[model samples]
Target chain A: MRTASPAPSRWALRVVGLGYLTLLLLAPLVAIFYKTFEHGLAPPIEAITSTNGLHALKLSLLMVVIAVPLNTIFGIGCALLLVRHKWKGNALIDSVINLPFAMSPVVIGLALFLLYGAKGWLGPDLAEAGVEILFSVPGMVLASIFVSIPFVVRETVPVLQEIGTEQEQAASTLGANAWQTFWRVTLPSIRWGVAYGVVLTTARVLGEFGAVSIVSGSRSGETETLPLYVKKAFDNFEFPAAYGASVLLALLALTTLLAMNVLKRKEDA
Target chain B: MGISVEGAVKSFGDFQALDDVSVEVPDGSLTALLGPSGSGKSTLLRAIAGLETLDAGRVTIDGEDVSTKPTQKREVGFVFQHYAAFKHMTVFENVGFGLKIRKWDKAKIADRVHELLNLVQLPGLADRYPSQLSGGQRQRMALARALAVQPQVLLLDEPFGALDARVRKDLRAWLRNLHEEMNVTTIFVTHDQEEAMDVAGQLVVMNQGRVEQSGSAEDLYEHPANEFVMSFVGEVNRLGEDFVRPHDIEVVLEADDRTEEGVVKRIVALGFEIRVEFVLGDGTDVWVQLTRNELQRLELREGQIAFLRPVQAKSFNGSTPSDPPGASTPQGSDDGGDAEVSAAV
Candidate 1:
């Protein structure tokens, strides 16, 4: 009755998953750090509090603070519209909502610039209203919002769909009004999903550069963000400064990831 | 509240879940919509409770047209088959959900929930969450929640279907007593015939998206309106009138010698049928059932003939009054209607 045990199929799947994860995720992250720290830490450490570096870092955090919350609200609205309403063209609307994910960030920034620039169609009217949008902090915020629109929406939609309308229906049948039902039932069910989406949006907003660079016009104190500081440090051949700022961006991303993990654990519970 | 569904029709994509179904549930009487699966019984129940919208027709409760009303406005208590007690809330909170949603005072909500829990025989389980309760206990909690609202009409959809057989039986009886005690207009759906007969004052049998029959359990069993209803309601042996119970026919031996008593042509045993065989005398070829010990004592054998006689019997059609059993199967029987029983001596 002594027989040898065969390897489980799951082990092969695990190996394949680990290999792909390492290649796609670990390799690129390690490469980023390797290139940044190759020259040593002094230059990078000094660059962290330097003039352009400080401006870029402060501007980037400010942009994320504004852009992430805006996108979070917009994503929740879009997800609710798509899931709860049976309006015509919902599919088309959903496809449009996802278009930002596929479109280039530069294209998004260029589109916003075209719309909000002084010479562009609506730009003159906006200028009359004393709204300086193009090549300003507003422009950078608008670009970040446009490019990060899909995260919260995509995260919340499937969870809302899976939770179904049953819980809300039960609440309604129990005599809870529409607002009460949403507050008590619908919101609680999708809170984790919304939290996950907001975290991802915050990450994308913090790391945004391509769109921000184009619309921001590299105004150091106002429009420039952390990623732009890294780019400026690299251009100036300040290797350690760029690497240190890169590490800071990496730390922000890690924080966002940690928040997402906590939220996901709560969702599982 | 009494509920009357008038010609309700509901369709889902292509399938007609309920097709022009109509039923009247009297006030304070526990009625059961008895049918096989997919017979639109649950659909009808949902329509009354306002959980489902009818494509056509109207549902009225207590003489008010509530067909278009939302579920919350209708004030109907619905108990789902899956004991849909709130998983996150304790029993007290679950039972108090209705009052809490309506913004009832805290003291009043607590007292009502406590009373309802006691009514459901779970007075001390108020602090326990639904996840901690057993199947029967969860079901009791669900009932308590439904009743706590003091809604006008109570709707239960297969309330006992998820429990084990033994537990289901006990719950079924307990529910009967609870219904009698509460006297709220109740309509429950179940496909089990025995459960319907034991619990419901009125039984509505459905088949293939239509109502086949509706009457008391005795009316349905003894006088089924159609062949489908007859076979679905209870077990019916398909034999000649003489072979059925209530028909008086002598059981005789199969031997050619002098017949001192009834004879048995062939002997076979089934669970309920202790000893059954075909009798040979009048060429009637009727089936017979005898006690196990009587067969062992009589030493009945095969291939024997004996004198046969019929005492009294009933005709399948009630057109003719009670007549003697040996009268004979008459001609011109319009349908396959026959007596429910044939007594064999």
Candidate 2:
């Protein structure tokens, strides 16, 4: 006999889930795209090409270029340290790595500002050396790095743990040194996990505003990253510019999500 | 050159995985480290391979000390139980890994890998990844990879443990033939006594982190060093302070003055032979293996009183007469037993 269809309750549950997602997520995304091109795309294009818009886009890209790679490297290092070895303070180190996820980004920005502000500790000395960290590009990049530190490490630790150390040991027995074993055996196995982490870190770094706003000072055409610029444009009654930048950011996040799904499928296959 | 472990002692916290363990494996001999689970056999194998550092003592390969050296420099090939083939790599790349690490030329690496695949009987399957191969094929690929570097010694920790019974049997025979051809000093750890006995040129029986006995299979079977060795090597019946194999005890229908009278509790016909469980007057259970023809002629059945005589048995030291059937008999025992009926000998 043929298998029976799913029960009525199962269908009901599926419909409810779809309806909720459509209302809360899909509808808003569609509305944002529709609003950006509501006036036939000319206004949106002009708003995006303006000097303020271009500068914000360039600064956001630069911030991501700096923060994503730095965080990715640090994440992999921390993940390896947490998963590969055991010593005193291991649990403490693990908790510290995950602290970024628990603490509010706003609080993190404030903490960075307090430590690097001109009147704050280490701030006066840095200012003497002509290094303006507070309300600067470096401060924004630092805040982004702080907010996204956990993405790669969290994604990679479980994968590293699941693969275990057998292959690495086997590589060693096959006359491979520690470096060779890591490069040849361990790294290849964990590359997908690292990539997944990097994708998440990139998305978080691009969308980060709470912590970045406090640290960046949101100056026009200077420290004004895309997210801050969106807020500035909206406040200045430039809806087309704000909506246009929001579409770009959303597309970036969407591309990252698609990449993550493709990588996951490849891993499964 | 052979491998030698001198008083290797390893401990994990308070639990000792190996204690004062010393074993000498001759060059070109296939030795099996035989023991039950957690008996320190795998631990000893890892220690010899330089995977596990000993808390005390040393290991030497080819008369050179390798205890303090890293695993890579020890020239030891190791195969894991789960066949730890590089999943992302094809068979060719996997087999060539060690050679590549040693900076072998590309041409040389290809030639060696080709030869190894053929030796392991998986030739022309070089482009397949580990996940694409069957369990047996994957195990063979692991073996080929381990052999690529032409290691001085090959150490396998339960190499065929994850395979099915039929595959395990086939691989065991194939391994025996491969060893005869390669002539590399090899040591494999296995909990399967039959696998160890069938393949190993020399068998080292271990228990509770100590080597119970070490010898040829026939020597260990015919004459175990102690009660532990006697029981661990093969199935045996304990009668007082003596241990006798089921085949070594004779079953007779008539009770004589010299024979021990017992009742047959059960009979199991195992195709070629019949195994009769006998409970003696002293309440000791003994198994007697009889030929099919003998069993048919005798027509022995359950509840029938029978007479048993030890055709050949060995008395072990520290084996109490009151000791239970499954007790851990002490080590360093005397090999002497009382054989009531000496006619068969």
| Candidate number of the best DockQ | 2
lDDT of 1 by residue, B1-345 (tens): 788988989988888888888898888889999999999999898888788899999999999999889898988888888776665568898888889988899999999999988888998998997878999998888888888888898888999999999989999889899888889999999999999999999999988778888999998876676556776787533333322331234444442232223345677766545544554444444555556775665566776544444433334445443333444433232234554333232
DockQ of every candidate: 0.37, 0.88
* Fnat of every candidate, listed in order: 0.32, 0.94
| Candidate 1 chain A: worst-modelled 10 consecutive residues by lDDT | A1-10
User: Residue A252: error of model 2 in Å?
Assistant: 0.7
Q: Per-residue CA lDDT of candidate 2, range B93-187, in tens?
A: 99999999999999999999999999888998999999999999999999999998989999999999999999999999999999998899999
Instruction: Write the residue-wise lDDT of candidate 2 on A207-257 in tens digits.
Output: 999999999999999999999999999998989999999998898899999
lDDT (Cα, tens digit) per residue for candidate 1, span A96-174 = 9988889999898888888888788899999999999888888888898888999999999999898777556666667
Residues forming the 10-long window of minimal summed lDDT in candidate 2 chain B:
B335-344
Docking class of 2: high
